[model samples]
Target: MALQNNEKFDIKIVYDKFEAALHEEDDIHLQFYLESFEELNKFFTLMGTVFGFVSKDLKAKMDILNEFLKDSNKSENFITVKKMIEYEKQNELLNKKGYTSGSRTLLRLHRGLDFIQLFLKKLGDLRDEESTSSACREAYDQTLAKHHPFVIRNGAKVAIYTLPTREILLKKVCGELDNIQKAMNLLPETLEVTAVVHTRIEKLYTVHDLHRLP
Candidate 1:
């Protein structure tokens, strides 16, 4: 069945919107675009359904951080990542075990996003089913494995083994086997855009980490 207009996934638009919002230097101190987190959750659900457990964990973190932003006072709003980091610094809330603060929670989500980006980019480059599966495993090892517990890592590996063949992925994303080349072309572009966004966010997190140090 053909995907409905609303159901169609456009990675470029999603990544671009996030890039614009995140790179708004003048707005770093202003309120974050709250709806962006909602959009991001949708993206995760769309891309990570095969790895349901991972998606669930990511959704939980995103929800917690978004709720924190929604509930913040005017002066202490956790809108931008920078503002979130600033609030955490002023309140001394970083690194508190068993406590959920916006900065730390967002950092977790950011790590998850990095994994998703890596997996998608790798999947985008596949030439066959075996390659697709290999890419997923490699991406998982390179990114998420370090963060996930042993059980979750093993579970993810099991899920990777169940991934649909490259032909199926092409048809799912590009809408037809005849359009496989189009899908292949699209993935690299998507990966490039996603990498740019990921790099920017990682840099922001790095800066936040440096500031947290003495």
Candidate 2:
């Protein structure tokens, strides 16, 4: 697939979708969360093949949740994070592996979201001419690296070195901005909104004790 130009993506759209995903304070609307994640994937896409594996991994996780939403019999249970957990657990559907239940699938995506939130915070904190690869490495180490196997980590270590410096990456993902400084300025609000959605999902998994799902 051809990579979409950065002009086609607005970083703020990710923040907006995540903000909308928050429902009734602690609850998250599943559809909005999926949509926000889909938007966030564009950032990886815009970065080019260096992060293709990250984007592919995230898409696979989202596809699982979308399948749950498409099932007529179980669609109601998949409408919100809270509902999905209750329905899946009450039915004893989470005992199996390989994302056989909504809870398990969403847990994978939630971990990916944590990596993204951490990555953005690191990106926002970078000084001039710093390597974006370091931010990617640090974020991956803290989040997804824990859940991933040795082979995946080895692959990511190679990909990380191919990333552009902070200035170039900011321009690639934030092409709509007048300059790199404006893009840097946009990161705080972006991270703030994303953190709220991440925290809600994190709490949901914590409450259900689903973090260790295979």
Candidate 3:
């Protein structure tokens, strides 16, 4: 769909709704870009990741463009992400030879992946925080561990359901992580999970460390 700013949509309400969606673990808004600010947030992360993956150096420069776009910062020359992706792809095609795929298709793919990233982040964060116990089952559960039955007398004796944290991550977050890790040189398990989560969630993107990324 064509994009335009609809003044009727309140940015403040959308912002608050975005946070509340996280807190409440809702997915309706995540399904569609109903809120403009949130839409931008998702788009930015996707753009950042795609740009980041293609070249470490280029990612850093494009990030300046994103930082400038921040509403908190006063800046001139707003740029559309689509246009930026288009331009970057064109340059890549012109400067290089033996192209593997069309630049236009790649650009669209990156932008589309960013959209997927935004939704997954909101979706996964909801459960990781909300479903898992407080502080990810580290709080009262730890204290109450003594009280909880370590082993069942007769039943399954399930203290905590044993689940491969990575499996949950794959199902809920980015399936791409699983594929990339298996295909590419082995990355630290945590990095793989984090990469998956980063694509799906925003807080990870904001974090400082690349390894600690997400």
* Candidate 2: stretches off by over 4 Å: 1-7, 96-99, 176-182
Cα displacement (Å) at residue 49, model 2: 1.5
Per-residue lDDT of candidate 2, residues 37-62 (tens digit): 88788788778888888888788888
lDDT of 3: 0.31
Ranking by lDDT: 2, 1, 3
User: For candidate 1, lDDT tens digit of each residue in 42-93?
Assistant: 5435444566777677768767866675674634556667776777777777
True-structure lDDT of candidate 1:
0.61
Clashing pairs in 3: 121-200, 121-201, 204-214
What is the C-alpha lDDT profile of model 3 across 145-188, one tens digit per residue? 32335442112112123222433433332235544344223223
* Model 2: colliding residue pairs: none
Please list the Cα RMSD from the true structure of every candidate, rounded to 1 decimal place: 4.6, 2.1, 19.7
Clashing residue pairs in candidate 1 (N, C-alpha, C atoms within 3 angstroms) = 32-79
Candidate 1: give its CA RMSD in angstroms: 4.6
Best by TM-score: 2
Ranking by TM-score: 2, 1, 3
| Per-model TM-score versus the true fold | 0.75, 0.91, 0.20
